[model samples]
Target chain A: MSNTKLVLVYKGFERFWHWTQAFLIIFLAVTGFEIHSSFSLFGFETAVNLHNKAAWALIILIIFAIFWHITSGEWKQYLPTTKNLKAQIEFYLTGIFRNTPHPTKKTVLSKLNPLQRLVYLGLKILVIPVMVMSGLAYMFYRYPQAGIIKSANMEDLEVIAIIHTFGAFVLVAFVIVHLYLITTGHTITSNLNAMITGWEELEEDENEPSVNDEPVFVTEPKI
Target chain B: MQNFKPILTFLFAVIAPLVIITLALREPETDHELLNQLREKYTHQHKLGIDHSKLAILQQDFTNPHAITAACLSCHTERGQEVLKNAHWNWEREAFIPGRGVTYLGKKNLINNFCTGIASNEGTCNRCHTGYGWQDETFDFTNEYNIDCLICHDNTNTYEKQKGAAGYPVMGADSPDFRNIVGHVGRPGRYNCGYCHFHSAGGNNVKHGDLEMALLTADRTIDVHMGVDGLDMSCVECHPAENHQMLGRYYGVSSSNTQRATCEQCHGSVPHTNSKLNEHVVKVDCRTCHIPTYAKVNPTKTYWDWSTATKRQDGKPYELVDSVGNVSYASIKGNFHWQKMAKPEYYWFNGTADHHLISDKIDLNNLPMKINTMFGDYHDKQSKIVPMKVHRGKQPYDTENLTIIQPKLWDKEANQGALWIDLDWEKALEKGMEYLDMPYSGKHGFIETEMYLPISHMVSTSDQALSCVDCHTRNESRLANLTDFYMPGRDQNSTLDTIGKWLILLSLAGVLLHGIVRVFISRKNKIAETHK
Candidate 1:
């Protein structure tokens, strides 16, 4: 293993934001489901209020994240890629089990692997937008001329409602799968530790390119 | 980065208001300013608590309730009690009861479906139940009848706190004013009935009756003319003694307080709005207007009744077909009777017999050469849109299919609203073709132009038809009309009373699938990167 100098990749606020956001998302999902009857943690009313507040907080955080990404150009890092894709797929299917080398390497500029890039890109494009739009729609919903509705035919409310609940379920499914994947990290706790301390130890590969003219297998701590 | 300066300015303009609002909200309460300062400034002795602030709040809540039962029971005793018994009471339960436990009960059934669903399956339903404490996960079924009283009486407060009740303390104790009259009297309109009528997650605040509950009560009430007042003619006087409740209610409603003569006492010969009802295209009354043959049509107890807006037969649309037109009900010996509510049978259509036949408009010569008509279908997927063929009443296109000797003749006796039905106006569309003649066209300016339009061209906003939004503004989208749909909350698969409730459940499922794919692909990449 070639020794390499540790370099900071993640800023302090980024980690704080990521963890706080994770905590809030989990809190929101639990309370939201409780409010929706999937399960209950907080009482319905409290869960409603907490869900609302958390949602608002998340919106605020998203606004801030958007600002941060725009300013720092980090959003560009999530651009979908198909580069060196075959080996990446094989690594997950068989190579990882056989202790084969990683198909794609990570760089400071490119924190996400190709597959991760595509997925993150998709989430940014599809999932989050639906959740935000649906949530906003649910909060501000109303039926004007409420009392007069009986006389008028109610056949008009067909499409809007389906979208709101559908968005909610999507967020719900994401939360469920995201929770299970946390255990898939290196050594189970290794990924967890990286999120916590912003550091990860990797094996050195002679064929790998170096960032600062150092051996590729060095300690990297991005915080 | 494109059009950076203009976009920046536009974005700033939008966000500037938000920042200002946030700053304003963050500022301390300005209304809490010392009365001492105002008093000193004027030095004129003023009635300290003189305010109609509560009425404004009451009105706002009645218009849009943040919480149910709390805004209603303040004034109407009967409606208040009904609200208390309703399921909306459990919108949030307290911790003392099962998450699904009852909070307030008033000698009625208290086993809440909401509670039952939550306790065993979730053990979490108690959270939304009344006074539910999420931490301990407990519920109390004691005060569950709150929705019943609150929605009707709109007393928003406990008995002692409400203003203007007869039991309210005399001047030496409690005073009466707008600020204090949190829940007092209600005028006649939709709010008078909206106590339970307006809706559910069940669909667009569905009102069983044509009356707009929000319009029922008024701060400045319109003069109620009980032509032959029911005995003393005081609606809120005897039954509730304080609030309004007609006699004979099993629960909190004034069930056995018979006051039949009161209907005749003040309303001696005529009924209020009777002249208007008689003049309208159809003859109707409260007893007749709300004659629902079906049970649970407006069941106050349930959170939602799925049967609303659906026909009982094929689970199709409510059949609002008006097959009854003016027909000859008289035989050789027609009785010319002197009366107020002229029986329709005496002059024309007998409800029992002449329903199938059509009537014709007669000229002085007694010949039905060309009977003018105006029945048109404005919107039905089945019916074709009959295009405009007339310009300002003069025929522009062929009048070959014009309603000359038309099958559907206008109801003649009642001028107040027949044109509405014949033309398909909105005010006369509820309660199986019951018609209401509102103060449209400034009391008599409505033009009577004969033109060939679809039966669907029922109501014309030619009055204020400048912009499409003006007529359609009642809702967000252009669904103010019967045929167009602006789906509420965009709630997909809205089975609960809302439209498309399960209308297109699969579309949402597709969106969910997309979301799942997005999350899975992203997670896979995250794991791979971690390994690398």
Candidate 2:
């Protein structure tokens, strides 16, 4: 009667990428906040240099991620889906709080819920791209007439910057919700361990196909 | 042990306030006997009083062609005397129409250094304008020192007149001079600076911002030839009270360290928030940029568009060009004016950082007051910065008001160089092991990264090379952070703000109307359905 079923889904590189990107982004946000003088977690100048370096590192990681996703065809995992759309919405509104049974059972083949697929798709397509573009604009923009910067436009940076910061806030909010949802998966340790060790103990009954079917693909167990 | 004996002095200091209160309550004797002696020295030319008390130390013998023995004169040599000669003695300089009249000492200038006129800008400069005292309606500038000793010497003068002291309409006062003139801070200022600064005083409406020449007035022109002497301001307001051992000069090329609210007084924020640039603003001046002398102009007004900068009055050759091949020349004309012609010059971006940031022809004569010198100084007579900049050397930076600017390259470029690496071992190692190699490249353990050079804290524009990013970076560009925050440099969207406000109001009204209509329609629809 265990809710957990043994499944091998997440790969070693995926775990590595997820944790590294998370740490790097959190580091960047912390240092970036300090640079903005939102609060001085690190000293001002140090924060600025750290933020700049972190930005460069994030760019590099993004490039590597794009390559990894494309080569492994993992990028397709975030494509939007409508299966269990009603269940996903209901779960968010009521089931989540009441601990009702999940409408879409998770398996090695299709690890993400419908809502996650949709949100992750939007983030990859819309938010992250905008954040990188606007951040670049702020780092490199200028006016040539008045000798030195005629004005120091920092706070509500240009229009694009507002979009970039808004994207950042969304990412932060998603991270918060994502962490909470992670705890709801099977046994908390099982879901957490999958991200760390690339394996999850899933319910064996979830092998049954869903009403609106999605083909499940499981890899050979590494161990 | 000997110092401990002053208990009685400490007791007196504690009781001083009570003593002052007692004095205020009682009638005091008049000190007119001292005034008569001062009057005697003035009438007969006794060559005394320059070294008198700080309040009434009249510059009797200190006047030119006359000599005064002074604490300053004793130490300063001939060269020092020459330095001291600068109008440090000139308590004030007011703008006067040259045709009106002249002073009796073979001086044709009729400028009056009236207290309200020059130091404390009472704003109504017309009230203290020359020809006569506009305030009293009786005193004339053709005569001299009608306001008495406190007029120039005492920044704060409180006369006790309940029994015998002078009251307001009797003596004027300004609080502790920012210069701490004679080191008496915490004392009420003896004069009024607002008299010379306010716009009505015939000066710039504000001290900083958009370089509009319209604020320039006849009374506070930077050009001496334009009769700047008539303005309601003077030297000590910007310059320091203490000077070189030679009497009145300081060691630096810029004469004063005075902090002026002129810029921030109007511009909402302190520009000093930026360390590197703010330090430069302190060392240099506002004239380094907006001075018309830097702008190339045309000799004749006929075909000239002043904004295009077609000529320079310094007689120095100037070459300027626009994006296309449009060319113009900056030529020197005969009355020290610049002639204009369509000939292009080289761009400022040709070499490294602006080589022409400061023109070489520039020399610091009058130490820092460069107007019409062979150097490129805009001696603006009708300057927008009237009363303040016009009254130079008066408000030099105070030592007590220390503004420190500390700039570090660490924030923008995360990699620490050898110097910083040694200084911050923890962060360096934490960042990466790569931080260790910077210190000694030639030693057994070698590192290849660039050495960290600690630059002198001078904001001067040097001809050092810069990368493409230097110009491209937002922070480095002249379009400062406020550009995005406050519609660039101008109130560009203020009109838009009005439109936005009105739009909000209309939207609210429309929303209310729409809500009412929807409610009415829903009710009607509900009744019809019910009837059906």
Candidate 3:
């Protein structure tokens, strides 16, 4: 226990966003599947209304998160890196089984490992964008009328619907993998506790302080 | 962070419009104040400038229906010519049917599941025809005097055309006084249109399930538009006429989308206060939701098996009435099945239709032939899912010729080979074929057929309209049969669904396996450390 120190790895807004987004994703999945006629829980109409509201909330949160990421210089944390990518993969696949230490060290400056960077980047750039665009398309689909000028009208919803559904599937898969990966932290509940309390128990020797010689462990809350 | 400022701004520039447009373009809640303003501006009831009873020409005692028409032509000279070109008098109108070029299609040549056609049954069927003396092929169509002026125009509602009298007014002691009827001529009422339309195919509530005599005194529940307690609109209100050429054309006869009397004509496209409901207007017709069920009051004919005809009751044609007082079986007609408050079948229709012509060849193996195909699908941009009253029946068809037979149904002469009079299928078929001058095989058999009559009327109030679950449900959706397009809730791609389930399951399994391995390794490491 002396070899490790408690570090404020996740900022306050980061934790807030993480939990809020998690709730939204789960809420969206439940109501979305209901709208897809999976089961009748809240009923079709209520399910639709709730799903639409959750989608809008998620979109607004994403916009705020984007602004936060850029202004706080946190966007660079997700920048793609080939450095130790293969080792990270091997650590998850086999190294974890042998009880070897994690390949990547957790620091306040670099919160995500190389694989996390790629996967999170893919979700932000690809999956979430696709979901949002397709969802918007579904909402603003061109309806036929007499007076209005016809412009780039989407006649059929087949493509948009399929794409949206596929995005939903991908999102669900990501959430499942993400929940499971949380358990692979230093302790079984360490990752979950870190996300909740914005602090993680990190091995002292593994973490290197920033160029400014900032303390490795900080008691003060960030943002 | 400063280096990415422009990129962030650019991203926002792209996203801001999407959000703004979404909020802005939500069809502003149908302006009720504007709608009321427009309704008042457009729907003022028009009154005839001159009272017909005050006219000197109408004061004369009319002898016959033709004589009454002659006197009408004397006053309104060009009115006779206008009536001649009309579909009612002509019995057929030139229409550009898709795949069949410009052809004259109407009740004159249109073949239906019920009563077939009017080719050989001209004498009996012509009672509903707008003109007089269409008893046979020799009857003059050019004679403007033959057009019955009082049937549609008679405000008295006493004008009754006699059965098998070649469209003449009933002449016996029970005859309506034409002199009084001629004096009170006005615009066509619901009763005037209902006289023929409601009672087509030999009885009331037989043809169009949406239309019936109950509409004359309909409350809001029966019909929101025509309900006396509601809008109190007449047939001509929705279906207006210009120079006697009525705007609406029945899809049963007409093919093209032109001349349609749509709710959009008066109500406009976006008629709902809820923008979500309004959004569906593009893909779903107003009638689809408004008309949840048709034939609300009277049980319309749903099934008629002509093969079961010719059955004699005490050697005389007799009707068998069901418990509901509906004629279940008629020796003259066939086994009839009737239903009231019937849920309508839905179809993706773009106003255009393809009718089964009398001359078209039929494939007997492919039974339950569609008599009229409503042409549209999910892909068609103009198409919308419309509610329809699908009348199914088994009618006489030529076994050898593979064509539908127009049976001679009625005649005064017992020897003239009318099926109603003689109860003989062979003679009726032969005479009907002779009348049409079309090739017919002597052999006749019953073939399963269906006629799609779009339910446009009998609109219920918004509260009575179908809820989201009605058509958007996993099981027993009203649009269950229409699988051409994906409707959320109602339709889910089975392949995608299976893949989605597998993806989630596989991810769960992978995580569980990894978790167990990690737990075991941690425990092993703990034991080894303790042993050390």
Candidate 4:
């Protein structure tokens, strides 16, 4: 406890984006499964209407998130490396039960571990794009007014629905694992509290460059 | 100019809010109100042009139906010639039945599930015919005086053909006054067309489920177009006549898609505020949703098992009523089933149908024979899902000839091989076969049959239109049987669904296991620290 110091790990816009995105994703899953006829919660018509509206909200949020990540240099945190990747896996497998230290350090510069970076990168580049594209296809499948765009009309909805549903399953799985891993921080509530209030207590070192000292690019930190 | 500008500004300020308040207080016109206004304007424009009572030619007392037609033809010289060419008079149309190659198909030759064919029963069925003296093949077709003009033009509502007098008016003391009826002729009303149409297979509402006697004075809920409370439209409004040819043609009698009276004639193809709903217009007919159920006020015949006929109560023909007071059984007809507010079955129809003609061969293995096959599928771009009353029944067919039997069901004289008189199937079949000049097999057996009757009337208002969940739901969907194409909520890939559920379950298990291990380690560490 004496070796640690409280520091800001999340910015205001970042926190807002993360929480709003989390709410929207949960809301979308509920409505999306209803559209699949899994169960009737909000009813078919209301669920479809809400699902379409929430999709637009998520798309707008994603644009803001991408802009913030690029401008704040937070995009660099997701760049993958083999460095400590094996150790992170090993820590979760057995070392976690034996009370061993974390393989990767959490700082303002690097928020995700090796495994998290890979998973999130796949989501942004693969899963999310597929979901959004297929969702847009569902929305614009028919254009009665556009007489010239008959060729652009999608003749089949089965393919689009399958792709969208597949992506939904993957997203739900990711959310579950992500929530569980939040407790793997320095303390059980440390990560959760940091996301909420934008501050976390990390191990302080005199040799390490702190946020108040200087701006340094630390791709791989030595423990 | 500055003083005048100030005065103008004061006047404008005073009038603006007053105008706004007046408008705000006045209620906006609903869709029904606007439609009623339009109907009122149309009614005012289409009054009867001439008074027939003022004409000197119509004042004479006609002794027979043919003499009345002759006197009417004196002034309307070309009307009788026009009526002669009409389908109403000839009971046949020059239609191109795909495989048959330019056949005259109609009630004259075609066999229906209800009454079979009209070849041997001309005298009884000709009560609906427009011309007089069509009792047999010897009846005149070229005579202009035989065309009965009073049947369609009689607005006095007293004109009615005798039961089996071959299109003649009832004679003797009980007959209608000819002089008074002749002076009151006008264009046909709803009852004029409905007199035969609504009573098609003998009784009221026996054939088409959407059309019944109740629609004559129906409210807006029961019917929007012909509702006395709403538009109060007539049959001729939609089925307008050019010369003697009407615009609308049913698939039962006519096969081609050329002369359809669709909603698009008045209401355009895209008639919805919701863009998604508007897109469905290309794939779904308006009747599929608007006329969700038919025979709403009265029960319609759904089934008629002719095999159950000929059951006599001590040698006397008798009829039985069901618990609901409907005719359940009769010695002449058969067992019957009726339904009220019946939901329609869906079919993909591109407006062309192929009928099972009387002379055509049949396969007994294919039971529940499709008397009329509506040709289309999901792949056909021209096809749309239409609502229809699929009347199921059993009718006699030849066991050896493999053809449907057209029995002599009615006659003006008894002991002349009429089923209604003797209840003898063999004699009726022999007489009917002799009339068609076709050989009878001497063996008759009942086969299950189905008739597709298109539902075009009794359309409800917009509020009663089918909701999205009605067909798009997983359970009890109206279109559940139409499985050729994918519907979003109703259909799903089973393989994908199974994998999806497993993925969710396994992820849950993985998280729960990881949580348990973490809690165990943390509790163990706390105990060791406290002991130290």
TM-score of each: 0.34, 0.35, 0.90, 0.91
The two-chain DockQ for each candidate, comma-separated, is 0.07, 0.02, 0.47, 0.30
Cα shift from native, residue B251, model 2 (Å): 21
Model 1 regions more than 4 Å off: A1-6, A144-160, A202-223, B1-532
Give the clashing pairs for model 4: none
Task: Identify the candidate with maximal DockQ.
Answer: 3
lDDT of 2 by residue, A4-96 (tens): 545556765567568877887788767754443345466654665566656766665677678878988888788778989889888755664
lDDT of 4 by residue, A95-178 (tens): 888878888887666778898899888988899899899998887776232244676766567888898999999899889888
In the predicted model 3, the residue pairs found to clash are: none
Runs in model 3 lying further than 4 Å from the true structure: A1-3, A93-99, A143-151, A205-207, A210-223, B1-30, B38-45, B517-532
- Runs in model 2 deviating more than 4 A are A1-5, A96-100, A145-156, A203-223, B1-532
What DockQ does candidate 1 score?
Answer: 0.07
- Among these predictions, the greatest lDDT belongs to 3
Candidate 2 chain B, poorest ten consecutive residues by summed lDDT:
B349-358
- Whichever of 2 and 3 has more lDDT, that candidate is 3
Off by over 4 Å in 4: A1-3, A143-148, A204-209, A213-223, B1-45
Query: For residues B17-94, could you state the per-residue lDDT of candidate 1 as single tens digits?
Result: 445545553424334134344325434322324333445435442321223244433433365444333333433212
Q: Give the C-alpha lDDT of model 2.
A: 0.36
True lDDT of residue B37, candidate 1:
46
- Superior candidate under lDDT, 1 versus 2: 2
Error of 4 at B183 (Å): 2.2
